[model samples]
Target: MAYRDQWKMLHLLNTSMRGALKETELIEMGIDCYPDTIQYLKDDGIVEMDGTGVYSLNPMVRRMLNKFMIAMGAGDMKEIYVDVPSCFIVMPFSEEWSDTVFYDFIQPAVIKSKMECVRGDMIPRVGKLSENIVKQIQRTGLVIADISVPNANVFYELGIADAIGRDVFLLYEKNIEQNLPADIQGAHYYAYDRNNIPESVERFAESLIQWKELYRVDVTLKYCRK
Candidate 1:
């Protein structure tokens, strides 16, 4: 099977509710020799099938396809089917500082907003750090960045999130002088301190809910206009 045909098959499976496909269904969609294509996809670890011929996309491949669709501005399809919004945290990876923020503020706040929160350190270090970070960022619906320190890795990840138009929330430790770069100087950020963590968590959750509502409205309007 040609590469394009394989893509079509994968796309169909991806957009389906259960990510399940049958040989007959593929043929009905005008795929020629779909069994061979399915075999090819299986060989590439892109899909898996049962003994009953019900095929489904591999979880990793499905996530990659979702990210691709988002990057391509296919927001309508992606938003409509997304089960849970994910927020990626970009912060300096330090045991003391990162753990305190993650457990005390970030995790609780995001869970309260009913969204999943993931950080770079949570991911398995199986590949290039830069590539892995960007891939995780691409898959998220939003980004929460902590710029309390002048961390290069955090800044780089934040840039990728910004370029992709992901809704972002900046955070900083209170009383620290923030010399934000020109690109993000005008952006609003939440300030927190150890003394006011509970209050900050409440505010952060509220802010995320508001941001998510606004994002949904914006996406809806854009798609309607098109």
Candidate 2:
């Protein structure tokens, strides 16, 4: 497949349920040349096309397409090349605690680990907000979620992160009554306060490094066995 055609085909498949698509749907989506693109992708072994013009990505290729979408959408292609881990910080976006959490804890911890940090606020507001958030989370190597204030948005993003099996680090402020939801109560978290920003940063950095190491090992072993 030509490069652009290949990308278009993959994009349509990734966004579709079960990565399945029909020829009519493709034409309606403005992909006038989708027939040739589907053939190209089929020839390249990236997609399977049936006699009825139904196209689907197998499990493996679907995952790769998802990663490609995230990289393209979030503009984090550098992370793929340099092997620098990226983190997504999920927290309340309001002015009250955003600055303190970002500057005092999240930024320092991420930088100390030589990782790139992305926040919801950093994403351009040009697209669907929830889709943008999901893409950012998909591109990240880690997620640091602050659930101190019981914000619904924070929890929603946290659910997405956890659902995707990303390494998640939970944080909450000290002295707050943390009635963690029942589902996540068993998860370990870091409790911090303004007075201990330095300590919190240090511990967070260490934990991130350790989690990265473990994740690397786990991935390596899985692929090796396969």
User: For every model shown, what is its TM-score relative to the native structure?
Assistant: 0.58, 0.59
Model 1 weakest 10-residue run by lDDT: 217-226
lDDT of 1 at 217: 24
Indicate the residue-level lDDT of 94 in model 1: 81
RMSD of 2: 13.0
lDDT of 1 by residue, 180-225 (tens): 5556853558888867889989998898888666434223222111
Clash pairs, candidate 2, are none
Instruction: Kindly list the per-residue Cα lDDT of model 2 for residues 63-114, writing each as its tens digit.
Output: 7644543433344321111112677888887959779988988899988877
State the C-alpha lDDT per candidate. Answer: 0.68, 0.66
Clashes of each: 0, 0
